[model samples]
Target: MARDADATKVRILAAATDEFAAHGFAGGRVERIAARAQSNVRMIYAYYGGKSGLFDATVAEALRRMAENVPPRPQDLAGWAGDVFDHHQRYPEVLRLSMWAQLERPEAGAEPREIYEDKALAVATVAARPLSPIDVLVFIYAIAQAWQLSPGGLTGLEEDPAGGDGVAARRQSVVVAVERMVHAQP
Candidate 1:
């Protein structure tokens, strides 16, 4: 009985995650989540307090899942980048919903942003030994932003002929050259 109840809550949470990841806080509907979960609306309120609380829980769960998959560390930078790229590729709606939450309710979304900041600082700390703080931040941010813009893993043929994999390869070469340039300097 207890196990069954727990399973139901987990199913509800999963349904809420998908719903929130698609519609965000302002657009998300409890009835839809309930229907998707095969549960009733009152179950959501009973389990999570209400829609806002569920949104917070859903966002926290989303970030928690991402953090678990990515784990913060300098050694895992490239792997983390790949994980993030794969996640966004598989679930662009999640990213879009996140962007919408940020735009619509900055205050309500503070926890997720704080989580991002903590992850960034952790990455910065690990990377700072070899690169300046600003440089590390820039490097991570650039890789993330560039990956988001390019779906084919950041170095593939694209809409712009001059900006295809060949160009990306060259750009990467230049970035490496610049990193070595800065590192080797007295």
Candidate 2:
């Protein structure tokens, strides 16, 4: 069989995403990730250099996928908020990995500032009112990702927090909150 380096790399990143999402950088195990990817630890280190490099690659892949699936809707920031909520809900691993990065790599810093700068600039150019551009983008993101950060991942308002009407209601709440913030006069 022809060796497929790209496919191996993809599998490694996918495995790392799930591992880090569930257990975070500190608790995530390289052996588990290797088993999940069907790739040896040596290959992982060769491709990513070390556990830290693997974690960075995993985070970058998650964010890249998110950006592709949920392109910014700066003009309709309210709708954008709803999209973010939906995106995170569908691919929760992305959100979990991000939280893990924040907790584990506080000094990573900027988080690829160009992406954020573009997003904030898009919002700022379109909506030049209320809060600053960066504020609007991040607040919407926080509202979208808040459920993941909630203790026990339950906001106390839902009996079955991750399903049915509860999720819909929470999503609506996120959209509404962002709408209010986007519309609030300075």
Candidate 1 error regions (>4 Å):
1-3, 127-142, 145-186
Candidate 2, residues 48-158, lDDT tens digits: the string is 998998998888888877877887887788888889888987898988888888899867651456667778777877846767887777788888888767887348666
> Model 1: which residue pairs collide?
none
Q: Write the per-residue lDDT of candidate 1 for residues 1-186, one digit (tens) a residue.
A: 344667777788788878877777888899999998888899889988998888777767766776676665555555554455556656555565566567766788524666666776776665235566456545654555454555664444555635456545544544454345335544
Give me the displacement of residue 148 in model 2, in angstroms: 2.4
- Candidate 1 matches the true fold with a TM-score of 0.67
Q: Find the number of clashing residue pairs for candidate 2.
A: 0
The candidate maximizing TM-score is 2
Show pairs that collide, candidate 2. none
**Maximum-lDDT candidate:** 2
Q: Quote the lDDT for 107 in model 1.
A: 81
Instruction: Provide the lDDT at 47 for model 2.
Output: 98
- Model 2: weakest 10-residue lDDT segment is 106-115
